[model samples]
Target: MRYVKYAAIRKPTEECIFCKARDEVGKERENLVLFRAKYCLVMLNLFPYNTGHLMIAPYRHVPSLEQLSDEELTELMVLTKRCLKMLREVYRPDGFNIGINIGRVAGAGFEGHVHIHIVPRWNGDTNFMPVIAGTKVIPESVLDTYDTLIKYTHLLRE
Candidate 1:
Protein backbone atom coordinates (compact mmCIF):
# COMPACT_ATOMS: atom_id res chain seq x y z
CA MET A 1 0.00 0.00 0.00
CA ARG A 2 3.03 2.31 0.05
CA TYR A 3 2.78 3.11 -3.64
CA VAL A 4 -0.48 3.06 -5.51
CA LYS A 5 0.31 1.65 -8.95
CA TYR A 6 3.89 2.95 -8.98
CA ALA A 7 4.43 6.71 -8.78
CA ALA A 8 8.26 6.84 -8.87
CA ILE A 9 9.44 6.12 -5.28
CA ARG A 10 11.66 3.07 -5.72
CA LYS A 11 13.39 1.12 -2.96
CA PRO A 12 17.06 0.53 -3.65
CA THR A 13 17.27 -2.91 -5.24
CA GLU A 14 20.61 -3.91 -3.75
CA GLU A 15 19.71 -4.04 -0.02
CA CYS A 16 17.32 -6.33 1.74
CA ILE A 17 14.51 -4.19 3.13
CA PHE A 18 13.99 -6.44 6.13
CA CYS A 19 17.67 -6.47 7.02
CA LYS A 20 17.82 -2.71 6.62
CA ALA A 21 14.81 -2.32 8.90
CA ARG A 22 16.39 -4.56 11.52
CA ASP A 23 19.55 -2.47 11.55
CA GLU A 24 17.94 0.97 11.42
CA VAL A 25 17.61 2.56 14.86
CA GLY A 26 14.71 4.99 14.39
CA LYS A 27 13.00 4.09 11.12
CA GLU A 28 10.15 1.91 12.36
CA ARG A 29 7.39 4.14 11.04
CA GLU A 30 9.09 4.69 7.70
CA ASN A 31 9.68 0.98 7.37
CA LEU A 32 6.10 0.06 8.24
CA VAL A 33 7.34 -2.19 11.01
CA LEU A 34 4.90 -2.93 13.78
CA PHE A 35 6.75 -4.64 16.64
CA ARG A 36 10.11 -6.15 17.55
CA ALA A 37 11.02 -8.90 19.99
CA LYS A 38 14.36 -10.20 21.17
CA TYR A 39 14.97 -12.45 18.16
CA CYS A 40 12.19 -11.59 15.75
CA LEU A 41 10.09 -8.70 14.44
CA VAL A 42 6.68 -8.20 12.83
CA MET A 43 6.03 -5.93 9.86
CA LEU A 44 3.45 -5.15 7.22
CA ASN A 45 4.03 -6.57 3.76
CA LEU A 46 4.82 -3.85 1.21
CA PHE A 47 2.80 -5.66 -1.42
CA PRO A 48 0.13 -7.29 0.69
CA TYR A 49 -2.13 -10.07 -0.44
CA ASN A 50 -4.81 -8.60 1.81
CA THR A 51 -5.45 -5.50 3.86
CA GLY A 52 -3.73 -6.81 7.02
CA HIS A 53 -1.05 -9.07 5.61
CA LEU A 54 1.91 -9.23 7.99
CA MET A 55 5.15 -11.15 8.32
CA ILE A 56 7.40 -12.32 11.21
CA ALA A 57 11.10 -12.80 10.68
CA PRO A 58 14.22 -13.18 12.72
CA TYR A 59 16.60 -10.23 13.03
CA ARG A 60 19.70 -12.44 12.97
CA HIS A 61 19.39 -12.69 9.14
CA VAL A 62 19.14 -16.45 8.90
CA PRO A 63 18.02 -17.74 5.50
CA SER A 64 15.95 -20.66 6.76
CA LEU A 65 14.01 -21.90 9.79
CA GLU A 66 16.63 -24.59 10.47
CA GLN A 67 19.17 -21.81 11.03
CA LEU A 68 17.17 -20.51 14.03
CA SER A 69 18.10 -21.42 17.58
CA ASP A 70 15.60 -23.16 19.82
CA GLU A 71 14.96 -20.01 21.82
CA GLU A 72 14.53 -17.97 18.68
CA LEU A 73 12.13 -20.52 17.28
CA THR A 74 10.09 -20.45 20.50
CA GLU A 75 9.82 -16.70 20.40
CA LEU A 76 8.83 -16.77 16.74
CA MET A 77 6.00 -19.24 17.32
CA VAL A 78 4.81 -17.45 20.47
CA LEU A 79 4.70 -14.10 18.73
CA THR A 80 3.10 -15.61 15.66
CA LYS A 81 0.27 -17.00 17.76
CA ARG A 82 -0.10 -13.67 19.48
CA CYS A 83 -0.29 -11.89 16.13
CA LEU A 84 -3.07 -14.23 15.07
CA LYS A 85 -5.03 -13.63 18.28
CA MET A 86 -4.64 -9.89 18.05
CA LEU A 87 -5.51 -9.82 14.35
CA ARG A 88 -8.68 -11.80 15.06
CA GLU A 89 -9.63 -9.32 17.76
CA VAL A 90 -9.00 -6.39 15.44
CA TYR A 91 -10.11 -7.67 12.03
CA ARG A 92 -12.48 -10.53 12.83
CA PRO A 93 -11.30 -12.49 9.84
CA ASP A 94 -13.24 -15.55 8.75
CA GLY A 95 -10.05 -17.56 8.52
CA PHE A 96 -6.29 -17.29 8.14
CA ASN A 97 -3.73 -18.77 5.76
CA ILE A 98 -0.30 -18.87 7.37
CA GLY A 99 2.91 -20.47 6.15
CA ILE A 100 6.53 -19.96 5.24
CA ASN A 101 7.87 -19.99 1.72
CA ILE A 102 11.33 -21.37 2.37
CA GLY A 103 13.10 -20.83 -0.93
CA ARG A 104 12.66 -19.07 -4.23
CA VAL A 105 11.47 -22.41 -5.60
CA ALA A 106 8.83 -22.37 -2.91
CA GLY A 107 7.83 -18.80 -3.75
CA ALA A 108 9.87 -16.87 -1.20
CA GLY A 109 9.84 -13.25 -2.25
CA PHE A 110 12.89 -12.50 -0.14
CA GLU A 111 14.63 -15.84 -0.46
CA GLY A 112 17.79 -14.66 1.25
CA HIS A 113 16.01 -14.22 4.61
CA VAL A 114 13.36 -16.53 6.00
CA HIS A 115 9.97 -15.15 7.08
CA ILE A 116 6.47 -16.44 7.77
CA HIS A 117 3.52 -14.73 6.21
CA ILE A 118 0.24 -14.37 8.09
CA VAL A 119 -2.65 -13.48 5.83
CA PRO A 120 -6.16 -12.78 7.09
CA ARG A 121 -8.93 -14.20 4.92
CA TRP A 122 -12.60 -13.38 4.63
CA ASN A 123 -15.55 -14.83 2.77
CA GLY A 124 -15.79 -13.53 -0.78
CA ASP A 125 -12.41 -11.85 -0.25
CA THR A 126 -10.90 -13.10 -3.50
CA ASN A 127 -12.72 -11.47 -6.34
CA PHE A 128 -12.13 -11.54 -10.07
CA MET A 129 -9.81 -8.54 -9.80
CA PRO A 130 -6.53 -10.39 -9.57
CA VAL A 131 -7.71 -13.08 -11.96
CA ILE A 132 -8.89 -10.62 -14.54
CA ALA A 133 -6.54 -7.68 -14.06
CA GLY A 134 -3.55 -9.05 -12.06
CA THR A 135 -3.98 -6.45 -9.29
CA LYS A 136 -5.01 -7.33 -5.76
CA VAL A 137 -7.48 -4.83 -4.39
CA ILE A 138 -6.59 -4.42 -0.75
CA PRO A 139 -9.16 -2.10 0.79
CA GLU A 140 -6.87 -0.42 3.35
CA SER A 141 -3.49 1.18 3.69
CA VAL A 142 -0.48 -0.76 5.06
CA LEU A 143 0.35 2.15 7.39
CA ASP A 144 -3.17 2.10 8.78
CA THR A 145 -2.85 -1.62 9.41
CA TYR A 146 0.53 -1.01 11.04
CA ASP A 147 -0.99 1.53 13.42
CA THR A 148 -3.83 -0.84 14.30
CA LEU A 149 -1.34 -3.57 15.13
CA ILE A 150 0.77 -1.16 17.14
CA LYS A 151 -2.26 -0.25 19.25
CA TYR A 152 -2.89 -3.94 19.97
CA THR A 153 0.69 -4.40 21.09
CA HIS A 154 -0.51 -3.13 24.48
CA LEU A 155 -2.23 -6.50 24.92
CA LEU A 156 0.93 -8.51 24.42
CA ARG A 157 2.96 -9.62 27.44
CA GLU A 158 6.71 -9.48 27.49
Candidate 2:
Protein backbone atom coordinates (compact mmCIF):
# COMPACT_ATOMS: atom_id res chain seq x y z
CA MET A 1 0.00 0.00 0.00
CA ARG A 2 1.33 3.41 -0.98
CA TYR A 3 0.37 6.29 1.27
CA VAL A 4 0.01 9.76 -0.26
CA LYS A 5 -0.33 12.91 1.79
CA TYR A 6 -2.89 15.54 0.91
CA ALA A 7 -1.83 18.66 -0.90
CA ALA A 8 -0.01 21.30 1.11
CA ILE A 9 -1.87 24.40 2.23
CA ARG A 10 -1.76 26.97 -0.51
CA LYS A 11 -1.13 30.57 0.51
CA PRO A 12 -4.03 32.86 -0.29
CA THR A 13 -3.65 34.42 -3.69
CA GLU A 14 -5.87 36.60 -5.85
CA GLU A 15 -5.44 34.50 -8.99
CA CYS A 16 -7.85 31.68 -9.61
CA ILE A 17 -6.20 28.33 -10.24
CA PHE A 18 -8.59 27.46 -13.07
CA CYS A 19 -7.78 30.68 -14.87
CA LYS A 20 -4.08 29.91 -14.58
CA ALA A 21 -4.64 26.51 -16.14
CA ARG A 22 -6.73 28.02 -18.93
CA ASP A 23 -4.18 30.70 -19.70
CA GLU A 24 -1.31 28.21 -19.83
CA VAL A 25 -2.92 26.59 -22.87
CA GLY A 26 -0.01 25.12 -24.82
CA LYS A 27 1.54 23.45 -21.80
CA GLU A 28 -1.25 20.96 -21.30
CA ARG A 29 0.89 18.24 -19.79
CA GLU A 30 2.58 20.60 -17.38
CA ASN A 31 -0.74 22.20 -16.47
CA LEU A 32 -2.56 18.87 -16.21
CA VAL A 33 -5.08 20.07 -18.76
CA LEU A 34 -6.33 17.12 -20.78
CA PHE A 35 -8.67 18.82 -23.22
CA ARG A 36 -9.85 22.30 -24.12
CA ALA A 37 -13.13 23.15 -25.76
CA LYS A 38 -14.48 26.45 -27.01
CA TYR A 39 -16.62 26.96 -23.94
CA CYS A 40 -14.90 24.80 -21.33
CA LEU A 41 -11.86 22.67 -20.43
CA VAL A 42 -10.94 19.52 -18.55
CA MET A 43 -8.01 19.01 -16.25
CA LEU A 44 -6.74 16.45 -13.80
CA ASN A 45 -7.12 17.23 -10.11
CA LEU A 46 -3.68 18.18 -8.80
CA PHE A 47 -4.52 16.63 -5.44
CA PRO A 48 -6.84 13.94 -6.63
CA TYR A 49 -9.25 12.08 -4.39
CA ASN A 50 -8.70 9.00 -6.52
CA THR A 51 -6.36 7.77 -9.22
CA GLY A 52 -8.31 9.32 -12.09
CA HIS A 53 -9.99 12.26 -10.41
CA LEU A 54 -10.77 14.98 -12.96
CA MET A 55 -12.35 18.43 -13.04
CA ILE A 56 -14.28 20.36 -15.70
CA ALA A 57 -14.74 24.11 -15.70
CA PRO A 58 -15.66 26.87 -18.06
CA TYR A 59 -13.04 28.94 -19.81
CA ARG A 60 -14.69 32.04 -18.40
CA HIS A 61 -14.43 32.14 -14.63
CA VAL A 62 -17.77 32.09 -12.86
CA PRO A 63 -18.66 31.42 -9.27
CA SER A 64 -21.77 29.32 -9.87
CA LEU A 65 -23.72 27.43 -12.53
CA GLU A 66 -26.39 30.15 -12.62
CA GLN A 67 -23.77 32.52 -13.97
CA LEU A 68 -23.08 30.33 -17.00
CA SER A 69 -24.68 31.00 -20.35
CA ASP A 70 -26.59 28.31 -22.22
CA GLU A 71 -23.61 27.49 -24.41
CA GLU A 72 -21.24 27.23 -21.48
CA LEU A 73 -23.69 25.13 -19.50
CA THR A 74 -24.21 22.78 -22.42
CA GLU A 75 -20.51 22.30 -23.03
CA LEU A 76 -19.90 21.77 -19.34
CA MET A 77 -22.26 18.83 -19.20
CA VAL A 78 -20.99 17.53 -22.54
CA LEU A 79 -17.44 17.58 -21.28
CA THR A 80 -18.59 15.97 -18.06
CA LYS A 81 -20.21 13.11 -19.95
CA ARG A 82 -17.07 12.68 -21.97
CA CYS A 83 -15.04 12.59 -18.79
CA LEU A 84 -17.29 9.87 -17.39
CA LYS A 85 -16.82 7.85 -20.55
CA MET A 86 -13.10 8.39 -20.49
CA LEU A 87 -12.86 7.34 -16.88
CA ARG A 88 -15.01 4.28 -17.59
CA GLU A 89 -12.73 3.26 -20.45
CA VAL A 90 -9.50 3.87 -18.57
CA TYR A 91 -10.00 3.07 -14.88
CA ARG A 92 -12.96 0.69 -15.08
CA PRO A 93 -13.93 1.69 -11.59
CA ASP A 94 -16.92 0.05 -9.92
CA GLY A 95 -18.50 3.48 -9.34
CA PHE A 96 -17.95 7.24 -9.50
CA ASN A 97 -18.71 10.35 -7.46
CA ILE A 98 -19.59 13.22 -9.77
CA GLY A 99 -20.59 16.53 -8.21
CA ILE A 100 -20.24 20.26 -8.06
CA ASN A 101 -19.46 22.29 -4.97
CA ILE A 102 -20.95 25.71 -5.59
CA GLY A 103 -19.88 27.67 -2.53
CA ARG A 104 -17.29 27.76 0.19
CA VAL A 105 -19.80 26.35 2.66
CA ALA A 106 -20.34 23.41 0.36
CA GLY A 107 -16.73 22.27 0.15
CA ALA A 108 -15.68 24.27 -2.86
CA GLY A 109 -11.89 24.23 -2.88
CA PHE A 110 -12.01 27.20 -5.22
CA GLU A 111 -15.29 28.82 -4.52
CA GLY A 112 -14.68 31.74 -6.81
CA HIS A 113 -14.35 29.44 -9.83
CA VAL A 114 -17.05 26.81 -10.06
CA HIS A 115 -16.16 23.37 -11.41
CA ILE A 116 -17.34 19.79 -11.39
CA HIS A 117 -15.34 16.93 -9.94
CA ILE A 118 -15.37 13.40 -11.35
CA VAL A 119 -13.86 10.96 -8.91
CA PRO A 120 -13.42 7.31 -9.85
CA ARG A 121 -14.25 4.94 -7.04
CA TRP A 122 -13.58 1.27 -6.44
CA ASN A 123 -14.89 -1.00 -3.74
CA GLY A 124 -12.75 -0.84 -0.60
CA ASP A 125 -10.72 2.01 -2.03
CA THR A 126 -10.54 3.60 1.41
CA ASN A 127 -8.81 2.17 4.46
CA PHE A 128 -7.87 2.95 8.06
CA MET A 129 -4.85 5.03 7.05
CA PRO A 130 -6.72 8.28 6.50
CA VAL A 131 -8.74 7.77 9.64
CA ILE A 132 -5.92 6.94 11.96
CA ALA A 133 -2.78 8.33 10.33
CA GLY A 134 -4.05 11.36 8.38
CA THR A 135 -2.95 9.91 5.06
CA LYS A 136 -4.59 8.18 2.12
CA VAL A 137 -3.34 5.15 0.24
CA ILE A 138 -3.17 5.73 -3.48
CA PRO A 139 -1.98 2.96 -5.74
CA GLU A 140 -0.49 5.31 -8.33
CA SER A 141 1.16 8.69 -8.42
CA VAL A 142 -0.59 11.77 -9.88
CA LEU A 143 1.91 12.22 -12.69
CA ASP A 144 1.59 8.59 -13.76
CA THR A 145 -2.17 8.97 -13.80
CA TYR A 146 -1.83 12.18 -15.79
CA ASP A 147 0.27 10.40 -18.41
CA THR A 148 -2.28 7.63 -18.65
CA LEU A 149 -5.22 10.03 -19.11
CA ILE A 150 -3.38 12.29 -21.54
CA LYS A 151 -3.36 9.46 -24.08
CA TYR A 152 -7.17 9.35 -23.97
CA THR A 153 -7.73 13.09 -24.43
CA HIS A 154 -8.19 12.57 -28.15
CA LEU A 155 -11.13 10.30 -27.48
CA LEU A 156 -12.78 13.25 -25.71
CA ARG A 157 -12.78 15.25 -28.91
CA GLU A 158 -15.12 12.81 -30.52
Candidate 3:
Protein backbone atom coordinates (compact mmCIF):
# COMPACT_ATOMS: atom_id res chain seq x y z
CA MET A 1 0.00 0.00 0.00
CA ARG A 2 1.16 3.55 -0.73
CA TYR A 3 0.49 6.53 1.47
CA VAL A 4 0.76 10.24 0.80
CA LYS A 5 2.12 12.55 3.48
CA TYR A 6 0.77 16.05 3.78
CA ALA A 7 2.37 18.76 5.85
CA ALA A 8 0.07 21.63 6.56
CA ILE A 9 1.36 24.46 8.70
CA ARG A 10 0.20 27.97 9.27
CA LYS A 11 2.79 30.70 9.12
CA PRO A 12 1.74 33.88 10.84
CA THR A 13 3.45 36.62 8.95
CA GLU A 14 2.67 39.72 6.96
CA GLU A 15 5.67 38.99 4.73
CA CYS A 16 5.09 37.14 1.54
CA ILE A 17 6.79 33.75 1.22
CA PHE A 18 8.30 34.70 -2.13
CA CYS A 19 9.72 37.86 -0.67
CA LYS A 20 11.15 35.92 2.23
CA ALA A 21 12.68 33.43 -0.19
CA ARG A 22 14.37 36.23 -2.06
CA ASP A 23 15.97 37.56 1.10
CA GLU A 24 17.07 34.17 2.34
CA VAL A 25 20.10 32.56 0.65
CA GLY A 26 21.63 29.08 0.76
CA LYS A 27 18.18 27.70 1.53
CA GLU A 28 16.87 26.76 -1.85
CA ARG A 29 16.26 23.17 -0.79
CA GLU A 30 14.21 24.27 2.19
CA ASN A 31 12.29 26.78 0.13
CA LEU A 32 11.76 24.32 -2.76
CA VAL A 33 13.27 26.97 -5.03
CA LEU A 34 14.93 25.44 -8.06
CA PHE A 35 16.54 28.36 -9.88
CA ARG A 36 17.11 32.08 -9.46
CA ALA A 37 17.53 34.49 -12.35
CA LYS A 38 18.31 38.18 -12.29
CA TYR A 39 14.68 39.25 -12.20
CA CYS A 40 12.60 36.13 -11.55
CA LEU A 41 12.91 32.89 -9.61
CA VAL A 42 11.33 29.43 -9.86
CA MET A 43 9.93 27.47 -6.94
CA LEU A 44 7.95 24.32 -6.34
CA ASN A 45 4.41 25.03 -5.23
CA LEU A 46 3.79 24.07 -1.62
CA PHE A 47 0.29 23.01 -2.55
CA PRO A 48 0.70 21.42 -5.96
CA TYR A 49 -1.82 20.04 -8.40
CA ASN A 50 0.71 17.63 -9.91
CA THR A 51 4.19 16.37 -9.20
CA GLY A 52 6.15 19.01 -11.08
CA HIS A 53 4.00 22.04 -10.23
CA LEU A 54 6.18 25.14 -10.25
CA MET A 55 5.70 28.89 -9.76
CA ILE A 56 7.84 31.65 -11.29
CA ALA A 57 7.73 34.96 -9.50
CA PRO A 58 9.76 38.14 -9.59
CA TYR A 59 11.85 39.68 -6.81
CA ARG A 60 9.52 42.62 -6.45
CA HIS A 61 6.38 41.91 -4.46
CA VAL A 62 3.86 43.29 -6.89
CA PRO A 63 0.18 42.44 -6.89
CA SER A 64 0.00 42.33 -10.68
CA LEU A 65 2.22 41.47 -13.62
CA GLU A 66 1.57 44.91 -15.09
CA GLN A 67 3.53 46.38 -12.19
CA LEU A 68 6.64 44.49 -13.27
CA SER A 69 9.37 46.28 -15.13
CA ASP A 70 10.17 45.33 -18.73
CA GLU A 71 13.27 43.45 -17.56
CA GLU A 72 11.27 41.58 -14.93
CA LEU A 73 8.63 40.60 -17.46
CA THR A 74 11.22 39.36 -19.98
CA GLU A 75 13.19 37.34 -17.45
CA LEU A 76 10.01 35.91 -15.96
CA MET A 77 9.06 34.34 -19.29
CA VAL A 78 12.58 33.07 -19.91
CA LEU A 79 12.77 31.42 -16.51
CA THR A 80 9.29 29.97 -16.87
CA LYS A 81 10.27 28.43 -20.22
CA ARG A 82 13.41 27.02 -18.65
CA CYS A 83 11.30 25.48 -15.91
CA LEU A 84 9.09 23.86 -18.56
CA LYS A 85 12.17 22.33 -20.21
CA MET A 86 13.37 20.98 -16.89
CA LEU A 87 9.93 19.56 -16.15
CA ARG A 88 9.82 17.89 -19.58
CA GLU A 89 13.23 16.31 -19.11
CA VAL A 90 12.50 15.08 -15.61
CA TYR A 91 8.82 14.09 -15.71
CA ARG A 92 8.33 13.75 -19.48
CA PRO A 93 4.78 14.97 -19.06
CA ASP A 94 2.44 14.59 -22.01
CA GLY A 95 1.41 18.24 -21.80
CA PHE A 96 1.22 21.23 -19.44
CA ASN A 97 -1.14 23.84 -17.99
CA ILE A 98 0.57 27.21 -17.77
CA GLY A 99 -1.14 30.47 -16.80
CA ILE A 100 -1.57 33.19 -14.23
CA ASN A 101 -4.56 33.83 -12.03
CA ILE A 102 -4.97 37.59 -11.72
CA GLY A 103 -6.89 38.18 -8.53
CA ARG A 104 -8.76 36.60 -5.66
CA VAL A 105 -11.88 36.44 -7.79
CA ALA A 106 -9.87 34.53 -10.40
CA GLY A 107 -8.55 31.93 -7.92
CA ALA A 108 -5.21 33.46 -7.13
CA GLY A 109 -4.10 31.89 -3.86
CA PHE A 110 -1.47 34.59 -3.53
CA GLU A 111 -3.43 37.48 -4.92
CA GLY A 112 -1.07 39.86 -3.20
CA HIS A 113 1.89 38.50 -5.17
CA VAL A 114 1.64 37.73 -8.86
CA HIS A 115 3.23 34.50 -10.10
CA ILE A 116 2.89 32.24 -13.09
CA HIS A 117 2.03 28.60 -12.56
CA ILE A 118 3.60 25.85 -14.67
CA VAL A 119 1.75 22.64 -13.91
CA PRO A 120 2.82 19.48 -15.72
CA ARG A 121 -0.01 17.45 -17.21
CA TRP A 122 -0.26 13.87 -18.37
CA ASN A 123 -2.91 11.76 -20.11
CA GLY A 124 -5.74 10.77 -17.74
CA ASP A 125 -4.30 12.81 -14.87
CA THR A 126 -7.61 13.83 -13.38
CA ASN A 127 -9.08 11.40 -10.91
CA PHE A 128 -12.15 11.10 -8.66
CA MET A 129 -10.05 11.66 -5.55
CA PRO A 130 -10.34 15.41 -5.74
CA VAL A 131 -13.95 15.28 -6.83
CA ILE A 132 -14.93 13.10 -3.92
CA ALA A 133 -12.62 14.37 -1.17
CA GLY A 134 -11.46 17.77 -2.37
CA THR A 135 -7.87 16.68 -2.00
CA LYS A 136 -5.20 16.38 -4.67
CA VAL A 137 -3.13 13.23 -4.66
CA ILE A 138 0.35 14.17 -5.72
CA PRO A 139 2.54 11.15 -6.44
CA GLU A 140 5.78 12.71 -5.23
CA SER A 141 6.88 14.87 -2.32
CA VAL A 142 7.78 18.55 -2.85
CA LEU A 143 11.34 18.01 -1.63
CA ASP A 144 11.86 15.07 -3.97
CA THR A 145 10.59 17.12 -6.87
CA TYR A 146 12.90 19.95 -5.89
CA ASP A 147 15.87 17.59 -5.69
CA THR A 148 15.09 16.21 -9.15
CA LEU A 149 14.58 19.59 -10.78
CA ILE A 150 17.50 21.34 -9.10
CA LYS A 151 19.92 19.07 -10.94
CA TYR A 152 18.70 20.33 -14.30
CA THR A 153 18.61 24.01 -13.30
CA HIS A 154 22.35 24.30 -13.94
CA LEU A 155 21.73 23.52 -17.58
CA LEU A 156 19.64 26.66 -17.87
CA ARG A 157 22.72 28.80 -17.30
CA GLU A 158 24.74 26.94 -19.93
Q: Which structure among the candidates has the greatest lDDT?
A: 2
Would you list the rank order by lDDT, best first? 2, 3, 1
Local distance difference test values of all predictions, in order: 0.82, 0.86, 0.83
* Candidate 1: residue 107 Cα off by (Å): 0.6
> TM-score of every model?
0.89, 0.92, 0.89
TM-score, model 1 to reference? 0.89
* Better model by lDDT: candidate 2 vs candidate 3: 2
User: What is the per-residue lDDT of model 3 for residues 36-145, given as tens digits with 9 covering 90 to 100?
Assistant: 88888888888788999999999998989889999999889888777787888889999999989888678766677899999999999989987897777889998888
- Poorest stretch of ten by lDDT in candidate 1: 1-10
TM-score of predicted model 3? 0.89
lDDT of 3 at 15: 63
What's the CA RMSD of model 2 in angstroms?
Answer: 2.7
| Model 1 ranges off by over 4 Å | 1-13
RMSD of each candidate relative to the true structure? 3.4, 2.7, 3.8
Q: Candidate 3's error at 114, in angstroms?
A: 1.0
Where does candidate 1 clash, by residue pair? Answer: none
